[model samples]
Target: MRKAPLASLATVGVIATEDVHSNTSVQQALASSRSLRSVTAPALITPRSDGRARATRTANFVSGQTAFAPTGVRLAFSYARQSEEFPDGIRRQHEENARVAAGLGFAIPDTPEFRYSDDETSGRLKSRDAFNRMLDRIASESKPASALFIRERSRIGRWNDPRRHDYYAVYFADRGVPIVESCDPQWVDWDNDTSDEVTLRFLHSTLKSIQSRNERIEIVKRTNRGTRAHIKQGFYSLKAPYYATDRWVAWAHTREPILKLDPGVSYVREGCAIILRWATDGSVQVVRDIFGWILGGRSLGWIAAELTRKCVPPPGARYNTARVDGPWHKELVRKIARNPIYRGDLLYGRTSQRFRGQEAVLAPQAQNDAFGKILYLDFLSDPPLSRGDFEAVQERLEANLYQHEARSRTKRNYPLSGVLVCASCRRGLHGFGSAPNRVGQVRTYYRHSMTRGEGSQCPHENRYIAAAPVDSALVNIVHDALASDRLQQLVASEVTRYLDDPRQRRRAEERHACASEIRELERELGRLSEELGQCTQSHWERSLRSRKDRIVSKLEALEAVGATLAQEDARLAAIERGLAHQEAYSATLYTLYGQAPTLVQRRVHEGLIEAVHVDFASRQVLFTTRSSTLGAEACGD
Candidate 1:
């Protein structure tokens, strides 16, 4: 057996720490050692114990030769945010970053592989194309980068949360690569041995993060103030004007029209103010017709369908190229009907977008004329609708929403509305009433809802069974089953089995768990309320109140769930009680069922029968209960 060279093993370990080119000696040693023939090449190359020492040795090893070295590579990332006020922002940022990199004695390669940039992007957002690419490149490389250069600390992120802002820096530092802020005075490398220098760097980064957040908040405040001022002066500031309205530029002081702006046209001029005016197009007539149709008792769906049929362009069609010819939706029609702008009144500040999230929260609309009134409009031209008509339309819309007018409409009665099913296709049969004959008698029949369609085909597609016979047959079957002792025993056994089921037991346990959670939340809420009431500090009070509010909301949701579970338990209990005392309950139900009116009979059928499946060819009806089925002969027409 040939002995392995100990000197070669030590050389292999040292060379592996620097680069993989030193693997030739290790291969030679492995070839010589008979016992080490089965050992893999990676087994001889283990990571160094000291990370700082390894990084230094690797850097020296790469610098001594001409081969490419990842440890010597310094990747630079630049970000630029663009807006209407700063159109040349991206170009300026690139120039400034180049200057900063030169001042720090680091040369950023002009090539795309060495340099990354996110143009026309906000640092507040997490998703950036070039930023993610740079991170992936560093992660996938066998030898990590020595440093990542940026213009300043804020270039990493101006995140609202400090934790998120520090996450990227920590990620690079953990990989033995330090982020170098060229503009930062106290910039320190990742391999810095002094604790004081590292602490100072961390403090500087934290302060920069805080400063960035404050700067963002200040910018938002200034923008909001300017927007409110502009709105108060009666300039259109929110978004595109409503349908049938055109945005026009007018002299600010004189209130004289300078020019009519076409749809989607936007420009900023020194002495000009933007205002909304009635459009001269045929769209005005369309808006008027919509109001008139709503007042004339036309449903929203019907109005949308009619507009779509006429190929009328809906609101926002001018801007949305894809949906220009799209069908009008009922909700769009409803919005048009609800807007107060058509009534010669401007409404703003109804909702507010928070700085932290994209969703808008409800804010009270401005009541005073400062922000709500239109200064340019004199109401000289005709409004979309008269004041009285507008109020009437609003009233009609409100009534429709609350379903108060639904009671006024005539309703047809169908006793077997959902109980009747076709055996052929296993689909529910709908009741259809025919016109009265000369004898003044109307015939009701139950037929498959879809006689011929894409779904399963029914053998008796054209066949229709008279509703009166089927209803009578179902009633007789239910009555007979209620009187039978065998059915009572079957129902009792099934109900007991269902009640004793593991799933049912789990449901009960879940209800108890929900109740326990609710109780715990209630106690927490009470404690928080007490703390909020006694707290002297404003910040502490605010925090306690927020906790209390969250707990209260959770309790309300749990209580709602508990109520639903209680209802289910009550329903099961009623079934158990009825089946337990079957003799008395059956007698009462059988007597009252025959004399019940259509509505009452419909309720009885839904409660007693799961489904009434009819086979027209065999002239047989199958009555399916909760746990069993009973068969009966069909009544003749």
Candidate 2:
């Protein structure tokens, strides 16, 4: 074996807060002291965001460029945040941010390969993303100086609960990347540094961490107090409005609605209006007629389809579907019959225990409302609607909601599928499979894939339908949806709107830059490849061969970079189109077509339709859309 000389050097990695904390006493101290500038600190590579009174931290900090130690050793960056709230979203954001940050560093002169990671844990010096990547980068090199950086101690890690102010400064100090906090140049003595000095640094970090946490507690207290007051003032505490359908919370400042209400509300409102219009003498009769049509012999889906075919408008007079319809589906029926809000009541709470590795679970409305129901049972009961009557009515309403439904659609896709259910059983209608095994010469039949388990108390499985027919049905539906002239106009309108967004414009610009870089990388790779081909190492050939090998390796890596950039550019383009055509397409599908298109159509239509609820028996699809104008034009009962 021949000895090899090390030629590659690792760069510095800065893990800082997203924003700078200008108001912090520490910050004030740094700003006021003239001597601070003489410290020969690492140049500010990525400035932090304003502390926002509590020093905000992002799971993945945004990337920026600046000078560092050794007068530009170059920098690589990554960030970490716990998955206690939104795991997947946080992870995705972290990974995306890391990639961007790494790319930014690569663009800097004399930069080394930058790596990224996002891990979930709170122990000091124990992050998988930070610690592991730090080890990987250092191991790849043979020097003690190549290392990682962090905004502050707490940002990287924390001590035990008892020693809440403590941190692991030595652990990272020993492995290089000796924890750079806020633009400070690498501490030469930090490696052989005394315990007392390190302890003092840790103490300062501890105080900062405590202050940040306290600030967060205060912010939450303030927010909750305001929310309680708002609740008392006849406004909802949660910002999501009954039908807003998009934002996590709607701000009073903007006065824009964004919350999506339960489809039950829409169904009841539509049904109520129709009942109100009928003669009081035959009002119950009308209900009976609907119930019989849905529960007795026909599937709720069939009845919903029939009503839609008869020109019935959905709740709020949006999207009348009687004239244009699909086949009846059980989900629409249950939504109408089992809705308590129609009776002027509210329900909330239930939670699913399912998981996707690190993904967090959102509590179901039924679970959250369980306690509220127990507390208000008597208070909410009407003279004729006793507690027992309420229970009975609930059962009857549910029964009325789902009279008949095909069972096979309930399996395959569970949690998500059940979310869209028939009102009676409140179980999602199983999708009928259509894809064929033409290559295998095998016949396919519909089969039940899920069940309600022992608690017929909730929803359950249904009978299967054949694959061939359902596949044909799907094709027809999609064809009809695509052919609708109104849908095309909607798409065009949305595309125009997408072109107007500032954020979209910024992303588009970035994507264009990435595309250009990819092209440049490809050209560079080709040149390198050609150079390697012409090289000879011995007889000038031997030395040339060695150089050529190195060049080829470099070229291959450059090609990889080009490939990544291309993928990123594609993702950005998809996002741009989605944001651009979001509204018009949704309105067109929901209003004119009377249903939100499937995931397939969504890709074709972009992020237009807000949601869709299918009726199995009636074949009338209920659509929830984002456009106010188109929604207003929809037919309500």
Candidate 3:
């Protein structure tokens, strides 16, 4: 290649010299040939055909290069919490980021790919579309960015935890890309290993994070104070009132009505308060009908179905027209029946707002006379239900709850009801009992839950299995395990391990706390009952009675919880004692198994078996015990 290119150059030079000694026409020809050579000489010695020559040339060119230096690439991210703050907030931050990048001698790509903005999104949240996309790009890109620009460190996040806010900075810094706050005067030099500079940068970041956290906390405190004040002034602070109730804006001090707000209208002037009133529409009649039906012994599901059948609009239909045709649910009926607003009373603070990680949640708070915060307002000329009727409704609801619990307890009668699962679809097998035949023998069978449903999804052809054999197999397994010494040791170790578990300790602590609350509530209830007996005024008597009733309700709930915990502890103790004296315990268990009711047998199965997966095709039954360490064993039917 070298010889060929050298020979071509020599030939061109010889032609040019010969032409110089010729006539004018020859000189003109030589000039034209020289122009051609100037155009094609570089192409003739091209490096495209040889890799080695190209590398050598590149090294030489780089060695001699001196004019230009490469600049760092800058990426920008902007975020705003509200839609109204966007465009202005996002645009200003981006422009400031570009100016800062230019000042730092960094090149910001003009394309939108390098700029990320999460408009109308909270920085305190963990998931944001644009923010996550930017992070993904940085992680997956072949060439990493030298710097990431934001209006301030808080633009990255205002996390509740200060350490969470610092995580982004540390993450970028560790990846060799330092986050640069455009608003900050002192930029961190992440590449430098100077201890003092690093310490200063770390201190600055920590201070900013703490400042952001303090500001957020202050905002939350101010909001909570305002909300409490608003509630105390007898203004509705929660979501729109229940169905048939209308919200009217009134002067805070005078209680003078300003206007009746339309559905979904939430705006209220600074000096105005929101008052709940009964609507003049037919919905008030519907509310009365619902309460009457509940008092008339109609079930909630039955009422919901009747309302849906009659094409009556459900709750929230006024706010959202789409819900006009939506079917009424039992839960909607339940809320209406349970709400005190129907009886011309306003109740607030039944639940408190809390934050779980980045998400805001509302947790139910225990209700007492002090924290329950009941306000009596004349919302309707004639309320839907009288106070006596409301109390009756509450009693009926409590009865319904107890009935529901009883029904649930007796719902599954077979010993293997919950334990048996279909291997094909992994669905629990539901138990069905056939009518007694001439011999007065009732046959029970287990069937897949989805096998006979309208839109059945289980593909297994053989879906039904006799429950008697499955129950017998489970009972035999339990008996065999009780007799085996190895199983006894395993059960002892498992029981000991479970008793020492942190979760069990937490449960015990919760039970203790629950019992303490129960005692406090009982004292409160006695005080209220005394007040009720002494009260001369009818209104005061009614209030005291209501308070007493609420305390009683709370006591019942807590007592129920304590009883459950006690039962669990007793069961564990019995198991431990039984394991210590196996002979008597085995005999007792055998006698109980032979004579126990279906409900007791079901409970015994639940205590011992984790799951029983049945495969019809392979004709195998897999029994998984409660002790996970023992693993599973297969047995033929």
Candidate 4:
């Protein structure tokens, strides 16, 4: 909001590398000239003696209206919303901090972090992307950060778990990086574990956590209560209609469910009662037919196939076209047969969130109650089927549910789910087809599915190859790469790391000693053989033969020891390489995928390789990255 010259305060030599939220290029930044302490940079700092090589605490921390922090101190701000719609408050707070940092001659490298966050996100979530990055930076030895700046402790986090709050504040500060929230009065230096300070910080953290949780709970409860109130007035807010587009007609209301402070003025309630009768619609006809078929001893699959043959659109097709596929799945048929909407009751508040993003499941009692699960008292519309008929259909459906589950469980599963994609359309290739049960042979291929149930098929041509061929091809590629000279170079560059780690370094040294001893024994055995050849005298020949046998036996034992040591040597080399590329890449291909099982190999390919595109018409497969389209090859071989 305001610009100020940064030549006034002389304190910290802060370098905002990239974004505060970024966890990349940390090791390079530690070794590179981009750090604030480098002579090439405008800032300068004398490193402290307490293990950390930058930012001493002797700098002027506070001066009247402005606060000038030491070199390598970072500020983290959690934005609060004044209005749910507009998040101008957090932006203004962040800008104000930057302006202050700028005027103090400190760098607050504006990396456009959280430039467009407010609309899509809220502060309640513990897993803030930027917050995680800040924590990662603080924890890193390569990225030397001495202190974290926050507007308030609650701004940093407001988890229901008090342990999480204390861990961030006390544990991190004890390790050297203290959280500084200048605006909040309750902020305590939890690093100084005094009875008074500990009590204050703990109490403050607990209260803030509890208050935030209670507020969120209240909001959810109020929303649910309002929805239920509306449902009672004949307009169902949660459950969808079975045969009709909307079960309760939305535009009918009996009375307002609120009390006005100004005698008789308040917002009017939306709807009152549902008078519409479900006589005959496509959805109604399907449900009626499904129940008839189930009673007549036809399977759910048979009913679904009959519906598909008749070209009838499945229920919820008008609402969600993407989810409704080419053929009717039995699950859809079961949902229609079991819906309470067909019997005129409107369901509300029947489910609660166990965890975020999970489909809210029915309460334990509701789920356990096989025959008496209908709990909602609100009757919104006239019944299509009698309650007795609905109960009978449900009883038969439940009796047959186990058989459906057994068939699904007995079906074969392919391991390469996450690996390949259609090169042309970039759609994932699904594995279909299975060998005969008694064939005793595995035969499956990953192909782009064009069937009705699979989400969006490729508009252009698609290609897929046999899974066995790709499995063989990938293993060969990985083995060759591991044996290449590139692997040796990677091992060499990371050897200097973890030098101070005495225990682990000692383990590496022992492996090295074992290799040296093996070489020395081999040289001794060579010399002994020459001595045995030179023994021409009959008296010396017997003694020489016995001595040579002893040497040969000892040499065999040493060689076996060296073989075991080789495995340890490889593991140690991998540890060194693992430290360097832990964030960027994975372990060596030999250790990871070369000797891995099919499931593990497929998972690695899915998680690592960004995309696999295939085209059947052109008979080509293309391997592409997250950013670009790369090499292409024919599908035949």
Cα lDDT tens digits for candidate 3, 486-572? 655766778788877899889889989998999899888888878777889998888888888888888998999999999988987
- What TM-score does candidate 2 reach? 0.29
Model 1: worst 10 consecutive residues (lDDT sum)? 53-62
Task: Report the Cα RMSD per candidate.
Answer: 21.0, 25.6, 30.4, 19.8
Tens digit per residue, CA lDDT, model 2, 1-637: 1111111111122222223345543221111123221111222333345424322111111112222445443343434444234447444544544444333331112223333334444433344655566556555434323334444444454433424333344444444434444324223233233445446755665676776566545544565555434332323433222211211223344434344333222211211111111112222333445545543455555565555555433333322344233333346555544533223233221122232133222222223212222111121122222344344545665554342132233333221232234434545554443323345243444333333212343222454434454434433444445445556666666756765668767765665775676566566657656765786654655655666566567657656665665686587577566655555554554454334345444343223334444444553334444452233112111
- Between candidates 2 and 4, the lDDT winner: 4
Better of 1 and 2 by TM-score: 1
* lDDT tens readout by residue for model 4, 523-571: 8778778887887898788887787788778778867776776776687
User: How many clashing pairs does model 4 include?
Assistant: 12
What TM-score quantifies how close candidate 3 is to the native fold? 0.45
Number of clashing residue pairs in every model? 0, 80, 0, 12
- What lDDT does model 4 reach? 0.50
| Candidate 1 ranges beyond 4 A from true positions | 1-78, 83-85, 94-164, 171-193, 259-266, 298-310, 353-381, 403-637
Q: List TM-scores for all candidates, in order.
A: 0.48, 0.29, 0.45, 0.40
Sliding window of 10 residues with minimal summed lDDT for model 3: 55-64
TM-score of 4: 0.40
* Candidate number of the best lDDT: 3
